[model samples]
Target: MDRRTALKHSALIALLGIIDVKKLFAASGNNSEIRGFHKFNLGKLELRVITDGHILMKPVQPNFAPGISSTVVEKTLDANFASKSEVDLSINILVVQSASRTILIDTGCGANFGKDSGWLTENLVHAGIKPSEVTDVVISHAHPDHIGGLTDKDGQVTFPNARVYLSRIEHDFWMSNSPDFSKSKITDEGLKKMVVAVARKNITALKPQLHLFEDRAEILDCIRIKLAPGHTPGHCVVQVFSGQESLYHVADLVHSQVLVFEHPEWGFEGDTDFELAVKSRRKILNELALSRALVFSYHLPWPGLGHVKKQGEGFEWIQQPTVLPD
Candidate 1:
């Protein structure tokens, strides 16, 4: 080989080795725990997060402003210490394991969305659950983050032995042949492909194992599905109850922790019905604060277990730290 080319290759290898070393050391320290998982027991109910990771999306101006002033929107974002008009949304999947059933609230981004997600399966296994052992897969909505993990990398069912549950309205909206599909706010073709793939595998078309429930249907003994739409046509949140203790899984009810909680009126472009979404957010936030029920949010930071506290006209979210099992 030519001397110059050989030396260049050696230098490249050395540089790569250095990068790897840095990453290894960082990972061994705090980096590996980036997407954390935590578990809590409310009497007999055990609720946990199988973290799927997070993403930074370019903030669309429509959802941020709508009727509000740009100054107000930008000021709110700035007040929250965010920049670049970028919002970081953390994704966490809820795992509810009890004496009666093993339920997963949302599937999370499947294997193909990129590196930021598709970790739910691994975390599930780590949490001492086999994919087949998941008895019920309850979807909060049909959004990608909530339903992506329905199929695995090979386009196979991730929870092969589980009964899939979803809101009938959510199922109908995505499967509708209406031209309104062209007007969807998010214009990503990948998203459309995902919707179509989901249509092909629509729970209705699957085994009788798939059941469609209307709003406010009780899925099992202590779990009730409540419709909290406006984010989508059929978005529903799952609430788990055991005696007096309860955990509310508010899926995508709020995306950006700051944008949703601090500026409750600000637009969230991800929602199909932006105006309606804001209304739903306000209502849900009010209920959450008043009810004092512990909430498990799908897009909140890892181990997204926390409560909403009333702050003036709006509210603030404070995530509870890990509660070590006794």
Candidate 2:
């Protein structure tokens, strides 16, 4: 080998030696405890975002964004430096503490989904919250990921002491003996069957503690349930207000932070009614953008708290900077 080539190789080896291998491994390791929770104040209420990890899913064609072309999807993803093949859909559990109660919105995917998820309980503990301490489990919908953590592997209730709340329409649709599968636009027969079965099993297990409510009802003190039923028969977004400050927990209205915001007309595969899903998304997104309200999106990045802003014909997600309470 030439002297110049040897010198270059030696320089590279020296640089590698200078790096701390152990520390590098530790930094990149999957330490769930450290990445588990985030807390912020909302007036007198304390809001916590408990992560249940994330699922790496391939972006399905047609269903991912029915209105947008494949070329557009590829270009947008590439521009964002996101993987064209797959995207990580994060499962975030929202916790709210008021003077009267401690409410949890949406349980995440349980152990049955995959190993990549089901860390909600572990993270809750890391956040200093006991399952029993949770006064209410307000479900945004009965989708598997949102309600899967309601029961444990033994088919027992996870939050033993908390009262379970869900939209009446959502509960009825899932519990129905004959649901109209045509509305969902799901071509995979096996996947559709699995979703129905999971919903029935989980909802049945929580029936004893279930408290179903209608739209616009004040389920809790300051938290109101707003029916946004396009994702499912009864998907709902929660509005939590204390004085003039408020936050909207928009569950599944926008699946991908980039795709959904940029093309509100795009449809998510999980939506039972694709057209309705788009309508609800556009309506809610417009209102949220106009009001400039802080939002908590379920499938966005971790902590999922952000703001919607108008961008040309569509919108954009502006993630709130992480700030801890005093």
Candidate 3:
């Protein structure tokens, strides 16, 4: 972490100190105030989870049935106090401020996607952050929700000066071919409609900022990108370090908190490769549980901050404690 990033981070949180958490949640209404983030200190580095919005989707199908009984899913939801059937997969964007740079882990679905989605920008501004001030934009994958905010409504670059980093596979998968939506089970028209906000032409032109990176590439001094593929071809997780303390920004390694942990093998129709996604999910979950490092899950309740733990034949996620244990 550098001095400049440190200063910006402190200023942003100090800004949030003025806003009441209850009032922020209340303003969100039915969307469920999932946009506000939780901030944690890693020695000198400051980590804040800025929520974009959420996805209310039906479970991934017959797999969502027997593999993890709806009964268990429902019970888990009840225990977590989350709404049943339609799960709210919250989208969280991470802003890491170290001594060197202010980096955003993944840009959330920008302001134009859906009424419920695309709140990242607004929330960032609310945190007293300017888009232009973001030094590096590290993309976990090229999925619409993760990358749609890369540009604005006018088809212009969203982060004009920031150097955008993405995995080689992720960039190729989305930019190269016309995705075969037929196999996706999602209607072609529907897929087209979903991507209408961020068409190919707009993405093609803004080529300079999007730099393809390989595994272990250091985006900044303390932040390193790891290729945790499967959710998307080049899906990734960013590891942030300051002294001995670290946090992993586990992007899309898990979607619905219940679905991913309780039944790691279940396929999400949204994932490009279902089998590989399961493999990646299980691998990451195991590693997370063992490491016991604080993790920032993009879609695991508001603020999306927690740690994974080993459970009966699987693993359980425990939210990060609000206060350090004495």
Candidate 4:
């Protein structure tokens, strides 16, 4: 080959080497997978957020935005560069270690949900925690995803050594013989009934070690339960305070960062009381935004820790950068 041609080829190869290989692979539909667990410290408290994987859900479902127009939903999703037809919903399980006690905020979907889910146990192992080592299992609500991992397929408690703490109102609501399904806004009546049944069974199985607490009760030294009902009759949020630092676990208060934060008025099908859900979401988000408090959401994304900021009439979720331990 001529010297000029060889120089030109060398320049082209150097240019290709300088280009971002990951970006090129992403353009070709390849991307790196998200890790299953993340850890960060809150003063003296050690917090670990574990992923149970994610599922792709259709955004056009009947109750996704009950009375909202498709045009508005599509525009909001498009603006965020999210999938127009589907949304990726993640399941986050929090593990808190304080004063020699290991606590779990909510269990993830077990073998029952689907193939994509049920990674909580595996991730827990990866985090160097065993089910038997968990001292307490604090449930925010009795939803299928949160309570499904309470027991195994053989109907035995998964956390054999842990005492389960759940809200009194939540336990009663699920155990009630006649739950007021008429008030539910879910479009699929069948799904609503199935969820109720599963919640009831899961709680019943854990009754032996169950310790129900009322609203605003301190379950542990630094952990307190705040009643935030709406998604369910007794849905609650768990707050962990260590010294002056605090981390709020906002469970299912906002499903999608784009849809819920950008448009809090939109109704979610999973919420039994749609209007109340909106009210609770706005009230809590306003407080968090005003206080600039750190938050750990169950469905926002992997690690789900961030701060809420007020934007126009709505709010915005600013995810915390992942920082691994040294």
Candidate 5:
């Protein structure tokens, strides 16, 4: 079946991180949408997982796990009991409410991608938050899926009331007259150009509200941006703290909870610096496993709240159970 046909035929709730979908399970009404948004609490802060939906990449060999063949990827998938053909990349956006601030870690794909992937805005409302109520937007990087929702087609900022924060390195990399992709494995020049166009547009629109922070800078009282690089020169992860509790928002550190966790050296073709990404992944994964801190993944399964653990050769993602507040 074709990609759309396959997706339409499949029930992807199980397809966890830019993940794995086994079989087709048709849906009715708001059920699928209801599945798109999840809520819970982290210490004194309230958090929400609002997905912009997902991206389906078929015959994942070339587009993902860049250095390996589809045959190799299939073997790994087969061993893990996941689908051996494609992936439904989850686009999980995090919303944080702390005392005086309502923050969004990464804006969803918006309409830049398509209908199936721009669910962030409405899902935000259903989750009882409004775009205008978002006081801050902490961008992990400038990928289309992460920043596309920042502005409308008319190039106007969507979250009018929010001040946007991005790592200074990330800001400069994309804003530079010539953003380099020499190290990227992405062979499609069109897609690369689109990346440039989309990034510059939304970033330029965010200029007035944009605040550039240095690596390891704590933009908020409880949230700090840490440099992770590799996927993009400026790509970074976020750390959220509450009292003694903390959660790491590891954005695109690895796209798949399976492929990446199983093999930190593998990466999607779009990685700006695949080798660098691998090094960063190994370094950060080590730290996370050692820290045993709670984590939130931008592309992991719903809610994307989990913990990291050392397994055989690599680490594993241990998802936390959702708990409702009294």
Candidate 6:
């Protein structure tokens, strides 16, 4: 090789040694990214949207947002100013401090799926609340992402002192001998079985601490379970009341902030019953729009606190601005 080429290669290698590219990438992945947790107060209640982690669903075609053409999906994403190639689904867990009870709405994806997720325990610690400090864990459904975090990889209970709560119907659906997913859009039997196995494993592990409540049961005199089945047999939303202020925690009602809001009738591939999911989405979105109450969405952007506004034929999510602490 020529002397000039050798000199250039040597300088490049020297720069690489000084730069520490691995450390730069590591910092980009961990330290440089914004922290996940958000805390605020609602009336007499202290509320927080803790981060669990996130998943990016790719293809954005028939699987991610079913019952629509790829062209339509592309147009919708363009209109919403989101990436036209992928769908971003964030796992935002709701934490409510009611009286002496520390209530957690849903645990995040624990040791499941990808490495980017399963950060619930770590993030919760960063939020100044230990898993043991959680007095109550209210589960919205039996989905893996919602209940998988209840236990660690070794099948150890994460919240040792917390009493787990879930709908009786939801518990039975997964615990039943034969789970019927005939109405589901997902046609892969093996994939469905894996999902069922995860739910059953997590639910069974927490059975001792699990407290099954009837639909619409008001537990702790502050949290009300609103029956919004469709995503699952026993899927529901939560209504948290404090003094005169209220926070309606709509768990997994809308996966996409813009697409779901723009077309409530559309089907999500994850929904067990697409038709029922659409109905529930429309019902809750309409009620929220009319009441103008605060809504907490689990799958929207981080700290998914917002209000629903009725648009022409559908609804729109109006994200609530973060208020600074005094």
Alpha-carbon lDDT, every model: 0.72, 0.81, 0.70, 0.80, 0.81, 0.81
Question: How close to the true structure is residue 274 of candidate 2, measured as C-alpha lDDT?
Answer: 84
- The reply for model 6, stretches above 4 Å from the true place, is 1-36, 323-326
lDDT, residue 239, model 1 = 89
Worst 10 residues of 5 by lDDT: 18-27
Stretches of candidate 3 exceeding 4 Å from the true structure: 1-37, 59-82, 180-189, 192-202, 323-326
lDDT of 1 by residue, 112-227 (tens): 56887777787777667889899998888887777878887667788888898888898878777651443235566676677656644645444467788998898678788888
Clashes of 6: 0
Assess candidate 5 and give its TM-score to the true structure. Answer: 0.87
- lDDT by residue (tens digit), candidate 2, 160-193: 9999999999989988987676876678888888
Model 3 worst lDDT run, 10 consecutive residues? 26-35
- Candidate 1 segments exceeding 4 Å error: 1-36, 59-70, 179-184, 187-196, 199-208, 323-326
> Which of the two, 1 or 6, has more lDDT?
6
> How many residue pairs collide in each prediction?
1, 0, 6, 0, 5, 0
List the candidates' TM-scores in order.
0.82, 0.87, 0.80, 0.87, 0.87, 0.87
Q: After best superposition, candidate 4 residue 305: deviation in angstroms? A: 0.7
Model 6 C-alpha lDDT versus the unseen true structure: 0.81
Off by over 4 Å in 4: 1-36, 324-326
For 129-165, candidate 3 gives per-residue lDDT tens digits of: 8888888888887777888788766667777878888
Worst 10 residues of 4 by lDDT: 20-29
Candidate 3, 14: how far from true, in Å?
20
Q: lDDT value for candidate 1?
A: 0.72
